[model samples]
Target: MPFVWAPIPFPDTNRIDMALTDKRRNWTPEEDVVLLTQVAADLPFAADKGQVTKSWQSLADKLVACDHFDRVVDGRKVQNMFTALVDEHRKFDMASAKLSGVDQEELEKHTLLDELLPLLDEVKS
Candidate 1:
């Protein structure tokens, strides 16, 4: 998908809450009015395969993700990206901790065994 900046709330209104796509959420007509009014031009991208195109939607998505495009973009995309990054970092930390139990000597032994599986298999038999 092209870059995007969701949409921001109007000057007199609070921020718009972006609901999950699967969720049955509703937006008021007033909110929609504010969203359309504040949305900038050329924020979408048309598919040109190898060629790169820019539009209001793409810019909007990006702005939303960065929190800088607050006026015309949703902030959820940024939140999701951050959440994913945090999850990946946590998983990496867990995996590294689990690997700590395997000493260098044992790792080397396993590496050699893994490399000579056919010969190691013969010996095992």
Candidate 2:
């Protein structure tokens, strides 16, 4: 006898709110570089109290105006993405610090991250 598979019925009324919301897409490397550059350029605005949202919205608008991406994003989305990037950078920086005798050449490879480091430090202070 062959085994039979049955499809489960999903009710429309019980649908999750997430399904109705916009689907998230992954940011490309180019997009990441562009975002980081934009953020670094506007670090002062970002550090200013109560101007973070406006800064992010400005970044989003700049990104959209670049005519590189097909999908549109809002300030919140850009902020979240920047947060994730910063988190990753923190983790990587911490790990690198733990390692002994890392070559200067290797460390210098992450030029973009290095450039943003001073801006981030300034923001913290």
Candidate 3:
């Protein structure tokens, strides 16, 4: 069955991202930008490693090394975080796919906003 939320007031914040994390600390988009920059810088080295799995593990290790802005992480945590990021992007893409005449920028705004609305509905016990 479909569920609905009662009408409640929310803050007039510009955007409230639900604070994704490795279950220990929150990761900001700014931190992600820095981490991704590091990944881009290290990707060539990771690519040189033979198998795809090893290369991914190497990347995960690098991510852990760069986790200072957030919580401490290991390869497995990095792997999980990476999977989450990919999943989020894919979900946005899938949502955008069904729409016509929507530009990437608009779609991104809508997708981010859409994700935030539900998160705002959660109440603490």
Candidate 4:
């Protein structure tokens, strides 16, 4: 079941019972860049052979095995994070793809600009 973050108000008294807060381990910006970069890089080599690519769960297992944090996240959360990164990659890919035919050099520049700029912007923020 999903977690509840709201508090329960008392009937008459000025007291309320707040649900215990869930303390999840937070990922750092450096870690985010590392993991996302890994995922993106893996995409190209994934189709190297006619064999099927590994699933997100497999990637999750690899991450968990190598992660330095004390918090142990399950495959599900890792899969979700991977999915979001893939979505962001798709967004960047689409931005570049939109300008594919105007000029070759311009397309390459636009693709590179859109790809790295947003990531830098996000990292700074």
TM-scores, in order shown?
0.24, 0.66, 0.45, 0.38
Q: Write the per-residue lDDT of candidate 3 for residues 11-69, one digit (tens) a residue.
A: 65444432332454667675555444544444422343356456556666666566455
Write down the lDDT that model 4 would get: 0.51
> Candidate 3 — worst ten consecutive residues by lDDT sum?
116-125
lDDT of each: 0.38, 0.71, 0.53, 0.51
Report the C-alpha lDDT of model 2 over 24-46, residue by residue, as the tens digit: 55777777777777777776334
RMSD of each predicted structure:
21.7, 7.7, 17.8, 13.0
Q: What ranges in model 1 sit over 4 Å off?
A: 1-73, 101-125
Error of 3 at 54 (Å): 6.3
The CA lDDT at 68 in model 2 is 65
RMSD of 1: 21.7
**Cα lDDT of model 4 by residue, 62-82, tens digit:** 666765533345556655655
lDDT of 4 at 121: 52
Which one is best on TM-score? 2
Best by lDDT, which number?
A: 2
For model 2, state the Cα shift of residue 89 in Å. Answer: 0.9
The TM-score between candidate 3 and the true structure equals: 0.45
Cα lDDT, model 1, residue 37: 30
Cα lDDT of candidate 1 equals: 0.38
Q: Residue 36 of candidate 4: its Cα lDDT?
A: 56
Which residue runs of candidate 3 sit more than 4 Å off their true CA positions?
Answer: 1-23, 44-68, 106-125
